[model samples]
Target: MTNALVFLDTETTGLHHDRRPWEIALIRREPNGYTTELRVFVADVDLSSAELMGLNVGHFYDTHPSFRTDSPMRLPAGDEEFQTGPGVWLAVEAKAAVLVERMTRGATIVGNNPTFDVEVLAAMLRRHKLCPAWHYHPIDVVSQALGFLSVLNLRMLGDLLAPELAEDLTPPVKSDKLSKLCGITPPEGDDRHTAIGDARWVQRWYDRLSNPLDGDDETTSVQAQ
Candidate 1:
């Protein structure tokens, strides 16, 4: 059977599902290949301009160039701002329904933390009185990996299980870790706080562990075969 695995990531306004999405990233890997898509559902929200300034927006734009240029992903402006309208929620619910429906055909949803995502999406669908066409079962990557490497502590186990991935910085850490590990110092650049970019980095680190190259250059984009 061809396994369908999906890695999903989301950024939202605070921690509440009712707050709406600030960003969403989904990375899918199948027997054919791997592909990723990202969307920024809202922008310039109710918070003050200064408050918005302090947000730790991940590298959403830098990694996902296509999304950066997409029109529908852009949020509206002014007091006539976009709230969680029925149509918008309907679209999300529809997509979730499709994703869930596909899963019933034997696909597995893999995520870092799927409990929250599934809960929120389920609640949203119920709130809209729409029955999604998929199941709620999800394979949590972090938990499974932890269980697999129960011998080591969390930090050490992460490094041991995926040493190459250890190079990438996980929130709050400088992005320099990856390059620095490779002994290559990257030039000065601002990181775009986008989810797609973060997923790309995570994927890169995962890739590096499985198939390492004998290169000293840090900027190599290793495309999967």
Candidate 2:
């Protein structure tokens, strides 16, 4: 088990391999219970695909700080000194630099669809000649919840299975639903598709699974401090 975990989430333009992340969130948790957070809105986003996909991730059209010229946010080249904070506006280059500085390279990642988050972040990092060296293993919240459900003999991942068989099928349980089935209360409304909201959901879900009460010994702690 990884003693350090970085719960990550990204709100992107679309669902395909060509998707671009416009918002990113990270919550780094250390064994001694120390926590740090960063949330930023990446500027220079090409929302063409987002328009095609009808994507308004995190209510981006209305909430992004960059959309308004007078908004106070940390900018890499401005007089504000570029401090990290939630809901700030940042250019991709600046965002990549800050992410490289802030990301824990050794922390195992935890997220729902963690690979998607990793790949998206990796693309942005590599664009600036930076590489992600986080711990090789990642915990997928959906998979973890599904594992718990599998032990009860549930069979509802037909969406994945049907893909192998080349059939069009929708699973009864999506990732969020699976998280909820395992006792995670996801955020509501505007926060639904936001990066920080989802990252917090990952953290809450993992803590719930790892620290069950009533003498439940089926789960173990993810930290070692």
Candidate 3:
């Protein structure tokens, strides 16, 4: 398998079925420590709905004011100033092409709970008349952690391997929270909602799982493998 992993995350307008992505962040990391990160602000959606989803104008203007003017339609200017009728459709198409090209190179997509990201990306690609080119099976860190803990005796595993994750591993344990699984605090600050920040956290959690600190037993050691 390729040692390249693509950590992806998206910030959407809403969680509704018809919602669309406004920002996307993809980080490609290699075993040699070479990393390439891409963050694109897609301008093909209803900004009004994005406002309702907590992505207000102030948020964009403060962080990326360029998105307002450089997007499909130039904001602060009227709809008459729109450069394209479809609103940045070409930009969306270009970004989608980049994503497809990178994924097709054999890099596996990884995310905290990647299903939503994959779904949103797929939807965006279809909307732009682009094909979803990545592998059907993406690596979901949350799901992997949950499945690994489901069959094991948490109490025993905790005592035998990761005592830090013990208390949080109570019976009927139900959560994919990285903080709970890794015994680390949830990421804060700019990392809270941004795609790149969240992707970094996902990568951290995955790294911990790949090289566990303490796991001598069969079950726990298998997790490291």
Candidate 4:
């Protein structure tokens, strides 16, 4: 197990590259044989059915075995919007706290689509005027999958190249998190667009695919402190 790695996932209003997360989830791999799960929500953000439909993101939660619920699960209640930028700042604050609490030097924050994850995270930090205490970057699993396969699409890659892990995941329709790809059935709980919850799933999926113990060279921890 990678003691220093932080598996990260995020849930946002939509797939817009500039969008911000309404919730966050993080799972830290401790030096000891323990993992910590951290979840946070932006209390002020609000989303309507129509706005979410416009993004075509309703199915991301509806189809997932672990996250479907009647009431919005894993999210704070109130009026909030990432487009306002203040909510983005709050998210950065929450993420930084999770990092410090773990006492990690540098984190390898793994995600299914790291480009968007990293960009949103960095933008959130900038909005908050905060910098992560540890060096963190979004690890793009798609690129990693591409390295293992000639063609690339989450569903296609999940079907062909990801057999080793796919058996564990629920096949994704559009923009599902990496957890579904890792065969990790989310616990029976509400997945209210929390970034940290999503991050934990991504981390687990990353470990499943790039576990060092399994003799795969792809597992790379951040620069050890």
- Highest lDDT: give the candidate number: 2
lDDT of 1 by residue, 117-157 (tens): 55654554465566544335776544443333233244554
Model 3, 1-225: lDDT tens digits are: 555777788777777676677666676666565666665555444555454535652245434423644542333433211123211221343454455455434577888778888887887777757777776778987766665656554556666655545665443444434346555445576566776577767766676666567442122101000
Candidate 3: segments with Cα more than 4 A from true spot: 1-3, 31-33, 48-51, 54-105, 148-152, 157-177, 214-225
Candidate 2 residues lying further than 4 Å off, grouped into runs, are: 46-51, 68-91, 152-172, 214-225
lDDT of 4 by residue, 61-118 (tens): 4532224455543333442212222212232345444433343346666666766655
Error of 4 at 126 (Å): 2.3
lDDT by residue for model 2 over 1-225, one digit each (tens)? 536788899888888777778777787777666677767667666666674443554566665656544564545564322434443335554454456335657788999889998887777777767768888788887777767766644445444332333222245457666665556678788678888788888888887777644332232323211
**Lowest summed lDDT window (length 10), candidate 4:** 79-88
- Between candidates 2 and 4, the one scoring higher on TM-score is 2
- Every candidate's CA RMSD: 9.6, 7.1, 8.9, 9.6
The better-scoring model by TM-score among 1 and 3 is 3
TM-score of every prediction relative to native? 0.46, 0.74, 0.66, 0.52
Alpha carbon lDDT of residue 11, candidate 1? 49
Using TM-score, rank the candidates from best to worst: 2, 3, 4, 1
Residue 127 deviation, candidate 3, in Å? 2.3
Provide the lowest-lDDT 10-residue window in model 3: 216-225
How many steric clashes between backbone atoms does each model show?
A: 9, 0, 1, 20
**How big is the positional error of residue 75 in model 2, measured in Å on the Cα after superposition?**
4.1
